[model samples]
Target: MTPVLVALEAFHVLRPLWLGALVPIAALWWMVRARRAHRAAPRDGLAPHLRDALTVGSDGQRRVMPIDMVCVALALLAFGASGPTWSRQPDPFVAQSAPLVAALKVTPSMTADDIAPSRLERGKQKIRDLLELRAGARTALIAYAGTAHVAVPMTEDPGVMLPYLAGLDPAVMPEEGDRPGLALDSAQALLSRETGPGAVLFVTDGLDPDDVPALSAANVIILSLLPEGQGDRGLEAVSDVPVIAVTADGADVAQIDRLLDAAQARALLDDDRQPWLDRGPWLALPAALLMLLWFRRGWTMRWVLMVAAFLLTQPASQARADGIADWFFTPDQRGRLAFDRGDFRVASEAFSDPLWRGYALYRDGQYADAAEVLSRVETAQAAFIQGMAYLRSRSYRDGVRAFETALLRDPDYPNAAENLETARAIVAYVEEAQEQSDTGEDRGIGADDVVFDNESGKGEETVISVPEDGADALLSADQWMTTVDTRTGDFLKSRFALEQNRPAPSAEADAPDGDEPREDSSQSQAPELAE
Candidate 1:
């Protein structure tokens, strides 16, 4: 549904009982206004010009009074208390930037240098840039010529997708054809595995008009690698799908980012699991702003202001109890003062509100206590803070859980999903390492027992050196991935051939005479990635 319709449908107050307060406030305001208007009515004994001169103020009817401001503010507070809401909150589990399956055409035409070094090369550059723009978002890659194959699965790591993206080429494909529809379908299939909202991006030199319906049906956007005037005929048919042409700068990537954000928002708005967003509190801001007018010379409540100032100026010491300040300031008020002064430990002890107390504890370097305390406050930011505390305490599993919960509450919570992924990865790595090292040999952090990991190039050179043909010089998986022991062209060729030669399921099940099922000829190589 359109946003306007959705808002109209969802518009309702959460605490409708609070709206009753507006009635009394409105009546009082009306009565006072009528009484003032009655008193302001001109006396029949006075002349018109003389009465005009005697009038002290300009047009009482049009003038706004302090009473009006108070009534408006009270009405706003009442509406706010009623908890007015119009839209559901987005699903917190969904990533802020939606998952994307990017399909790049690997046809010979992509190698054409009409635009630059090559259309294919430029497309790769665009994908690389887009990955940077969508750093924490899950992304997959596909290559299609005569057919389509998943080069990379959904992953947050741009590192994983880049190598496979650079490997795609026309020569690697077993067959040669412009089958964008196949590529689009493959991308859609990959995206279907994900539970949250996602989009499909087709990076191609040209598209077939026949494929327009498929693209239009899905959340798909096209990045045309062809020059401005070259691919108009095919692209003109793409009336529904957004077709973004190649740009000299980063404009194409920016446009793609905007499209992705918009698609994600659209999908989130339709999600039934999302909660209603509380819009009532937003009304308080205008009310508070309007009430600022009461601080004017005559409108000021001098005694009330003085009393407030006295309370705010009280000593911030958290240890003080039953003193004059204690009678004046609440524990939270004192805690706030202490917190503002950077006495976090004092603030942590003094704070009565669980949320504020947890924040103060976190600031005081009591992470475990902070995490435990923050659990009581069920909010996205609270959960996020708690997650950080867990990570800080080396509780990876707990950290992951906290981050996930935070995302479930608010998907747009900054860096929550990314941190959750990192925590999960760390936990997995630790578990795997422990399982592999189950020999139960004792290890220590001694000079000889210092195992190195995640080492950069120059740093690795300084620690240990191995001769080229040493017996123990077996290349690790990480070493092989970075250095590329196998040729990209050879790998793609074998995989493409395996998939192409695989028999169709229907052909295998139904023999010509319907006597028996046919056996597959290409049984040696399965059409699957060798993980």
Candidate 2:
């Protein structure tokens, strides 16, 4: 279980280390040969028929004895030297004693009839279940609608937290908008009050962006409560924190099991402090016994049995090939085909497997990974694949460099020049885009409305307007407006007041009426943003 034990177990597999073991085998062979030659000399003068005969002398020496025993002993010695082992690891049943923090989301559309009992209600039920499952651990509950507010501070008894959570409804927080990032920050702050290694369970419909990176950085595990048919749509992250998923629409037990399996996989990778036993000593014993028997039974029919045992005990070389393939195409190989077809998502999933991660990254505009994958390739096709990955990832400089290097080895190559040009174009585009976005003057803010809160009473009335035809372009253009204020910004109090009055305008405009209101043509909200 200790680090030293693990290191020692791994060291036994080293060729140089195993070679030292061969010393004992060599000594055994030398001793056996000396004994055999001495025994054979006395029997040489006997008749040819009797020379090979088995005999029991009055001095208690036996000949032509049990070959099976000798073979079995040799096999044991060989097996011991090879260091076979079995580990009886402890059951991972003990639970953590740390307190937990739960962040529950209550959004406006949570009242949608799509889910039975509503998404918010069902989420509360699951949280209740999770709390019941947590033994006596303390937990805090946070309820957020448009914004977040702590429902229950950390408490050891779920019973104490249940009443506070029971009062939770969509109306608990003012209807501003769902912002999981802010909610997560509040939950994290609540969790910081507890002692020991605490965790957070954020149960939300995927209203949030891929918060995996942020949540993981916060050292909080995320358990996504996706509605049925929802999957990670557009997210990219390399997070150490584990994510478990459960569907709102009665998730199949199999899906839960998969989630658990994923969690376990992540734990194995991240929880290095977990115990692992040394199995080397157990294996060495049998290998030593097998080698002893191998010496006792000189080239005989018993080798057939030894071969069978070896075949049964040791996996064939083909297994290594299959392992490579599995690592490359884990869960599915849809990603590789998708990458080939220019589908980035599938390629990304396929890249999750270590074997293909590099390739996936390359196809997804990750040139660094492509170069790494290309470096690992052993075949000509791999070199070409690596080159293409580099090209697609927009590493035109690297792609051109790689192509030139490969061409020197094989002239008149196919497809290299075409990829080279593509990479060059991507490089040009990247440079241009970078320059365009960076230049202060190039970003046209005149077309973009500069909304300013007139807190500072500057007494000049200036009418700076654009033509109606160019109004949209002006609004859409990149612009930054400076604000002059004596007070530090605080929107929460104003937002709370607005929510209480129900004065928030509907995202969709009613009819355009001169008396009703002048539509802010410059500040139009997107349809989804209205939600």
Candidate 3:
């Protein structure tokens, strides 16, 4: 049932609050003016029949025109013209949050040719679909290679996990093995201990060594995504961790059942499942049609001056809607939604907008600029983003600081806390590595550190040298000969020269034929000129 409200939103139509006050004042002023005019005018004598007819009494009857009622009706019309409208909405319903976890395998086999584009990409697509389907669920992302890394901690936003998944390169960590046990342990770490209701989905090419016991021990619902056609037949499990085996192409019944069995995850086909009746078609279509008909009839205009008032009130309406919409929706999110609906260019523009310029800078490894832009975002989600930007920028100190700030604002903020710990660990690891490198240890930053370069065609490399204190001398010497672009490297060379107390070139040589020769030079013997 819809109840009518006076719709204070109409007041928004009045440009200025004081202008509304003028309504009563104008009426009073007009009344005073009429009284004065009546006092000044002289009354002329008239015949009884003539006076009776003029008095609205041609039949010898006198009556007063309901002027007060007429004035009231006019006032009501003016107010209605102020664009009064009723907002009809259905009864409020409670929304419940679902618990969800996405476990992605970062195994080397995932890069195999069995899947088109690769098993990892296919897994990411499936996970994206699952995330979209479970909109309001608390989600987490765990990436398992030789070891497991919590790509994203458990939280409400599943979208943030998208980039970490997308940017995954097998070459980043040595041709590392995929450890399912480590992945399960990480997944279990993310779940709430009190309630084992969380669902864990494993997206892999069924190549990881079986860790069915760990999976079962963690009470994780394992939904295994296998290569197309082939199932997880040989990939036997040590424990009965119900495996929901699905084709690499898409999610299937086999996959769903396995997932459900593993974690006791919710299944739609089950009789215990409660369905949400989609009344959208029933309500939305009829409401839209009714609105169209109502607008076409134009009867609402008689009592409400909506059309006329809307033109006068649009400025305020647009402002309010924009302010609120901008706060709740990020440009990237809006653009992605549009992209999902097939508006590619529009979505791309939104994602590439200046507002999110920091993210682009961060992606390019310019951490400082990223930190600046991300810092402006005050929400927990933004803080989490800023933390990532800082971490990628190699500003672990700043990244940790940002995560700490986020924790203060939202103690249980999922991604921030996990990354905060990671950032701290990274800082400590780097310090220890630097110490080791200083002591004559020829090892690289870490035993498994990997750096990949797709653009230069250098897949990945491990830097094993403890770069000499003056390593720049060698690179700069080569750069001086124009062997490489030394734009910033030149600046570093100049700075090093300054630190060494190198003297500036002689003024005479730097004069460029613009300065005068010294008179003292004439007293000295003339030097021989080159032939």
Per lDDT, the best of the predicted structures is: 1
* Worst 10 contiguous positions by lDDT, candidate 3: 522-531
User: Ten consecutive residues with minimal summed lDDT in candidate 2?
Assistant: 522-531
Q: Worst ten-residue run, lDDT, model 1?
A: 518-527
| Candidate 2: tens digits of C-alpha lDDT, residues 1-531 | 333344344343212344355566556655654564466335566885675465434232343333434444554455445554322222211112345568877776666555667767777777777666553446777666666655666665679777666666665567657666666766666655333345566666654446556765764545555556666531225246555555544443233333433333333324434444335456545544544554454534455467867889976555223565664444445555555454554676655454355545543566666678656655433454466655445445566566665555555445445444555555555555444444333333344343322223323222344446854634323332333332211333343345346543321111122221111111110000000
Once fitted onto the true fold, the runs of candidate 2 whose alpha carbons sit more than 4 angstroms away are 1-99, 208-213, 230-243, 248-531
Give the alpha-carbon lDDT of every model: 0.73, 0.50, 0.49
Clashing pairs in 1: 89-275, 92-407
Better of 1 and 3 by lDDT: 1
Q: Give the TM-score of candidate 3.
A: 0.33
The C-alpha TM-scores of every prediction are 0.60, 0.34, 0.33
Comparing 1 and 3 by TM-score, which wins? 1
Give the clash count for each candidate: 2, 30, 6
Per-residue alpha-carbon lDDT of model 1 for 297-359, expressed as tens digits?
A: 766545548877898999976665687869757899788878756578999988999988987
